[model samples]
Target: MSILRHWPSVRARVGRELGLVLALAVVAGGVLGFLALADLVVGGETVAFDTQVLMAFRQAGDAAVPLGAPWLPTVMRDITALGGTAVLSLIVLFTVVYLVLVRRPAAAAFVAGAVLSGAGLSQVLKAFFDRARPDLVPNAPIELSASFPSGHSMLAAVTYLTLGVLLARIETDRRVRVFFPFVAVVLTVLVGVSRVYIGVHWPTDVLGGWLIGAAWAMACWGVVLWLQRGRPALAADG
Candidate 1:
């Protein structure tokens, strides 16, 4: 009887501890991301690191010959397309429609808002930095936009992670809940890597994209959690 009585208290304590840990993690991530962006903007050591990594992928004297198989460039181009505007937009549209059909209009709206806002923020930051593209690589993609942060990397992180969290929320199985976000992160990382492989972005660009995108996704998740907290009974009923 005493053990049973104490079990509830123990569980509650554990839950509170977990919540605290998660909150701390989110704050730490956001702070680190902002620091990185500030360093990049101020032309700190990060710039040198970015240049070194960007150059390492190319041949010593010839930026055109990326250090990979002859066909790797083609493969990277294909992989990069997965994070392009067209593909991500289609993904967001389909997800919103699916959520609406399933009668979760709020969740659908959250998804749309998170992705669209993230895309807009990316453009604004790019223009604000107005950094030039890497001219070291002759075969790099011809991008006219500023290149401080890669659009593909940031948008991919935002869209995929937002969808991942949404999918995880609907899963009843614990394993499935974990799996959804894991796959989402994997896809995001792959997309970012493809940008560097193709020489369209500096390493720091992708890093900045991932950091800001993740921070944005986490913020949206907090909103979802807050909104849902008030409707626990309704959530349980569904």
Candidate 2:
């Protein structure tokens, strides 16, 4: 009877442990992947892959025209805008305000801190790499910044995934927990792909951005979990 009565607690503890382990593993893998890509990119080894991928989206003999339905370019532009600075900033602002209004100050701080730190890290990485935007095709948005690690892709992953994890942690429903993170992943992927499709960022640039951003988000979550381990329940729930 006691065993059965305590089963839910045991299960929850195990789940938390497993989640921590997975987050750490992702951090390790993401760092390694980013470093490997950086080495190749610095050595100019990714030029062929980058050029091929960039050109694949362009119409034959015309770099300006993307190969697809007439409206596809417009769609891509809109999708890319979802990860733009203005949109992401507004999203973070609103989310933080919502969290605060609900009296979840810790959660609000966590979200704001994670996003701001991720943005700073993205800029640092970009400045270090000093990579130029792809010129194989005319850029749709006409971006003018260092482009090794795409700011849009990184910021999207950081913001959406962080929010997803927060939502998942507070929710009790299995399906809802799964749904939030899944949508976050989808949105992150779409933003990254849009950057590449619109010729604003190299494929590797997006890849690097995703790797580092995910690692950062996971690391931040892991720290929060560690900090909240002593409490009876998730701080997020409070």
Candidate 3:
């Protein structure tokens, strides 16, 4: 009788704990995959695959001419701007300010720290790889930085996804929670695809950026979860 009475509560707790474990496992897997990709890229093992993919977006015979409609390049350029420094900075600033206004200084600080650290990490990775930009396309976006991993793609993932996760956590409605992360993912994907479409980054560069950026975001989220779990009393008080 006693076991039966407590079984439901025990099962519920087990289910919740299991879910956390699975989420942690997924984050770990992502980090490992990113590290593997970094190794392969550094070893120059993905050059042929990268070239083939990048060239696919170009004219069949002339690598200089991009494929698709006449206005595609213009559209892609606009999309890529979403991941650029100016726009991302504005978005981050607005998000931080909003969080502060809502009396969530800890959350705001976390967002700022995650994004700034990701940006610095991107730069360090680029310097380490020291890969040159592709010259296959004539009208490629002008860039003067090392280009193994696309910084725009990586930073966009970090900033947008981090913000999404944070916003999702505070939402009481399930639909709104789902919507925030969905929008963040769509933005991240669009930005990465635009980098490739505009011929600024090799396909593998974008892939690497996505991998590392996702890993970094997941890692940060894991840290946040840990902090929250360690402060159940404080959370309850708040």
Candidate 4:
């Protein structure tokens, strides 16, 4: 029997809930991707709200100059560096070590799968959209990929938020469990913004990344819960 169908009603209900969330994410990602594709076909340009996001990205880039707030730019740079290779390596190394140390090999596999999937999806979307990065800023970070949704933002959301969901199982305080992931989410959002501020990404790009990441993360969490359903006494923190 397919696990979803084999599940008892309670587990089935949980699966359905997860299915719903994942469905929504798929719909949202599809819609956003379609809209972006359409925009590109029709001479890609931001609509009003999207334009605002781009403007915000631009202003953020300008403000990051570090004249008055010397450290502000540096801080933003660190966050913005999420797209850089060094940061990516750090994330990879940390995840590998953590999972190995904790003996949660499955957790590591799921996380690696989910993060890599999301990252690949983001790149495919970029190529499909084939949108161009803005020329408004000076010394734009060397990006040659299509700029529809920010890859950094998308990957960040997928990777960090997935970790957050997994972490939720380990911390049962209700408050801590729910809140910490939210903090990760907030930081992910900031990381997206930092990219925009650096003038390396269009605002819409980051927004797309956020939407995609959120949707994918929800879907992964649903799968994990489904797998863990029968064994309520599973490793989750209460």
Q: Pick by lDDT: which candidate is best?
A: 2
- In angstroms, the error of model 3 at 65 is 2.6
- Every model's Cα RMSD, please? 3.3, 1.4, 3.4, 5.7
Q: Per-residue lDDT for 109-183 in model 1, tens only? A: 888999999999999989888887777788577989888788998899899988886776668698998999999
Q: How many residue pairs in model 1 have overlapping backbones?
A: 0
Q: What tens digits encode model 4's per-residue C-alpha lDDT throughout 1-238? A: 6766766766645744665566566647745774664565447456555555556544455633423255676788898776554686588669867886877677777777887788788888888877778666666578888877778888787777877767766675888988878977887888898887767777777877777777777667667666665554223222
Give lDDT for model 2.
0.89
Candidate 4 ranges with C-alpha deviation above 4 Å: 1-70, 83-85, 232-238
**Candidate 1 residue 42 C-alpha distance from true site, Å:** 2.4
Regarding lDDT, does 2 or 3 come out ahead? 2
TM-score of each: 0.86, 0.95, 0.87, 0.76
Computed on alpha carbons, the lDDT of every model, listed in order, comes to 0.79, 0.89, 0.82, 0.70
For residues 120-236, write the lDDT of model 3, one tens digit per residue.
999998999899998888867689998868999899999998888777767769899899989999999999998887788988888888878877887777676655553531112
Order by lDDT, highest first: 2, 3, 1, 4
Query: Candidate 2, residues 115-199: lDDT per residue as tens digits?
Result: 9999999999999999988877764667778998999999999999999998898888999999999999999999998888888
Note the clash tally of each candidate. 0, 0, 0, 2
lDDT of 4: 0.70
